[model samples]
Every structure is written in structure tokens, then in C-alpha cells.
Target: MKTRSGKGNRVGLAVLGLVLLAVGGLAIARALGSFGDAAAREPVVDAGARSFAATTPWFWPVVAAVGIVIGLIGLAWLLALLRVDRPRRLRLESGTTGVTEVDAHPASEALAEQVSTYPEVRRAHAVLRGPSDDPHLDIGVSAEEPADLGALVTRLHDEAVPDLRTTLGLRRLPAMVRLNLTGGRRTRPVH
Candidate 1:
């Protein structure tokens, strides 16, 4: 069974994209007179619904309430997307100090820059995930060439991780490294 990690966001965004594309295409088609001149003359909400909304005293208020509810839902969704898994300024586990904190984004950015300068590495990006006590280091490294992948990963784990741990004042930090080997023009093999 496949685990669902960020799949919902992917699927939701994909469906929203398709819907938005369709709506845009329809609007463009209408603008180009694909639906003929009669479409522009048509009532947007139809005559029957318009008449009911006009006659009923509570219709407009109900519609307004529903619109507000939808607006609130949309706002909540936006907030959730912006929310992070952990705090931006992480508190360090100081042995004999009153308080100590580190900004996660800056620390990750520094680590990424350091890794990118490593031998056989083309580029790197790092993100700190999870809580401060048990944080996960997600590093994406692009290798200069395929042959250097093994040595690059080994060097990254042995040297870079420990160095980051020391900087963060942590004893252990679990890292998840994603390595991508940069490929050039491929030579055709004769069978």
C-alpha cells in the first residue's frame, strides 16, 4: 500500500488547475463569439431563479450567509497552506542556559550553501522539518556527475551532517538526503 504524503494537495491543485483552465478557455471562446451573439444576451442566473430570489424576502440573506461561509472556508484553507510543521525560530536544548533559539530557514539555507560548495556536488538545498528536539534534515543535492554520487553521499553524511549538528548544538540529527546526478548528452550504444 502506498502512503499518502502530500497527495491530497497535489490532487486538489491538479483538479483546480483543470477547472480553471476550462473556465478560462470557455471565457476566451465566448469572447471570440464561439457561442454566438445570443450567449451575451442570456441572463446569468436564469429567469426562474432570479424571480424566486426577487420574491422571497429571506433569499438574499441566505445567499449572503452561504457566500460568507464559503469565504471563511477559503480563508481557512489559505492559512493551513501557509502554516509550518514547526516554529520558525527553534529553541535549542541548552544545558545550562536560560534560553536559546535558532532560525530554521537561515540555518537550512547556510547548510545548503555549504553543501553546494562540496566536491562533485553541483547544487544543494536543505529544509529543516519536524520539531527541534527530533528534527529531520531534508537535503537535496545535485551531483556534478553520476560517477561521483557514492563518494558525495558518503562525504555529505560523514562531514556535513556532524558539522550541522555542532552548529545546532544538538547531539543527533536524522538526515534524509536526496541525490540527483546531473546527466549530459547520452551517447548511442550500438547493439
Candidate 2:
């Protein structure tokens, strides 16, 4: 199964990072006297504290409400992290004329096994995506040394893909195949 992109998560993380960086940099700069001398800053702190002391009683309630809203946002973010998307299932017909449902995981495993049997491939994995009735495949293969990649691609296009489509009763079996070299070179003993 394929997972949806987490663009929202990325944006949230980026904004949080920038806010932390700005606030931390400001605090460090103030502590390091980048703003001015320490003696000159004493009056500014005293004036700010005096202004805060003059606030009306309603100010505290507004601050508490803002804190609650921030807490709710945190709760929502946590929920999103925990959420899982269910995989779609493939429907098949049994010899008894009954209908059967197969999960994507098992179907993908079968496909991976079929593809891995090729002499050039060291290992293979497949993932099914989209609805079960109309699915797409993402296949990854590890090739042995001296494997002919071009011939393999041709075989997939001509034989493997058509066989998969026919077996699955699908009109088209859209697939993405990735190949990687599996390093297995043995060192020889020197004289």
C-alpha cells in the first residue's frame, strides 16, 4: 500500500522550527548584550513589569483561553500522527462460485514472489495502491551481478505485465519498477 504525502506535517514542523529559532536567537542575543549594556536594560524591565501590574482582571482570562486553544492544537497534531489509513482489498471468485476478498498485502507478496523468480533478480517487493478494482503497482527489485537490465525491462513489458493483468482480471496493470544492484563480489586470495 502507498501512503499519502504529509505536506501539512512538513509545513507545521517548518513553522515551529522558525519560531523556535527566532525566539531562542533573541533570548541568546539579549543574554549576550547584543541589544545594549546590561545596566541600560534594567529600566526597560522595571517599566514593563509596572505596565503588566496595571492590567485589568479580564486580561488573565484571555490568556487562559489562548492557552486552551494552543493545547487543543497540540492534541489534534498528536491524533494525526497516530492515524492509520486502511489498505484496499482485491475481490476474487472462488471455484465454488462464491466471492472472496484478498488483502493487498497478500496479493503484493505473490507478485513479488513471481518477479523474484527471474534469474537476474536477487530479491523483489511489490506494493498495491489505489482501489482494489483499479490498482497500481510499485515494484522494487535487487539485481545480481552482471544482470542485463535492458532485457529484464523488455521481458517485464512483454510478458510479466501482461500475465499480471490477465491473472488479476485487470484491464491495465500500471506499474513502477525500480532496480538496484545487490553487491555480492567475493575477494580472491593473493599469492
Candidate 3:
């Protein structure tokens, strides 16, 4: 979801931020007598605005409607963030013999555990995405700060990824690995 809507979210946030900054800057300018002391003391809506609002009965209703629409849009965006499209079960085999269905979550978890056991690894995670037939794997690994990143990455490409593909009976399993370095410091004996 973030991948798809990332650009839109960024643009929207940028526009909203700019608008807010302009409003806040105006308020601060008024407070500092950049506009006037009277402007600072007066309500946000001036006499002309207030008179127009009073004369036009639809003004308050329009404002209320706009607020509701914005609120609903924000609620939708938040709900979209919570939505997951991950495939729960993966079809390992669907041959002339029979169908073999495997729970993707457990399989991915086991893979993560396997990777976590590697030397210098602190923690790991794995997620399976896309359709049941053809799945995509996303792996995250956190290693000690002093870990040999080159060796770990090489192992992932040479050993772990191929092993997973072989286990899942996949010709090619597209895997993305995200590596992080843990902030933990190994204790040293003070001389």
C-alpha cells in the first residue's frame, strides 16, 4: 500500500505542511506586530468576513461540510495503511497427482529463524507476498554492529535463498533482503 500511494501521500503532506506554515507564519507575524497589534488581538475572521458569513447562511454549513469531507478522506487513508494484501496460503504443487497447499506464514517464519541462526545475526524476519502459485519473499535481518556484512550477504545469496527455492519447489523465488546493524556493543574487560 505504501509503495503504491507513497508519492501521493508525500505530495499531500507537503501541500498541507506548506499551507499550515503559511497560516502559522501569518499568526506569528501578527503577534510580533508585523501586521499590527490590533490584528493580533482580533479574531481570525475579521469584521468583513464575519459580516459576510452572517449574511450568507450557507457559509458555516459549507465550512462544516468541507471539514467532514477532509476528516473522512483522512480516515480512509489511515484505514488503507492498516490493510494487508499478503497471501496466507501458498500452492506449492498442483500436479496431475494432487494439490499441495502450504501455510506461507509458518514457512516464512521458519526461513527467518534459519537466517537468524547465522553467525553474528541478532534478529530476522520474513514475509511472503503475491499470489499463491508464485510468491515473493521479503526478508529482514539485523546483525551485530561489528558483523561481516559482505560474508552475510554472500551467504544469503549462495546458501539461504537457493535452499528456500529448492524447499518450496520453485524454479525462481524472487527474494529481497533488508539488512540492519544492531546498536549493541559487546562488553570488554577494562584493563
**Model 1 TM-score?**
0.63
**Model 3 lDDT vs. the true structure?**
0.89
* lDDT against true structure, model 2: 0.77
lDDT of 1 by residue, 1-191 (tens): 11243677678889989999999998777766789887756655789998999999999999999999989987987887777675487678556657788898988899999998887677899998887666778899887655567778788889888888889888788999998878754689999
| Candidate 2 lDDT score at position 135 | 75
Candidate 2 segments exceeding 4 Å error: 1-8, 38-88, 91-100, 185-191
TM-score of each: 0.63, 0.67, 0.67
Give the lDDT of residue 72 in candidate 1.
100
Where in model 1 is the C-alpha error above 4 Å? 1-55, 82-86, 94-97, 184-191
Q: Write the per-residue lDDT of candidate 3 for residues 93-165, one digit (tens) a residue.
A: 8989999988989888888999999999999999988888988889999998888999999998898888888
Give the Å error, residue 68, model 2: 7.3
Judged by lDDT relative to the true structure, which candidate is superior, 1 or 2? 1
lDDT of 2 by residue, 135-184 (tens): 77888989987789999888777877777668777778799989898876
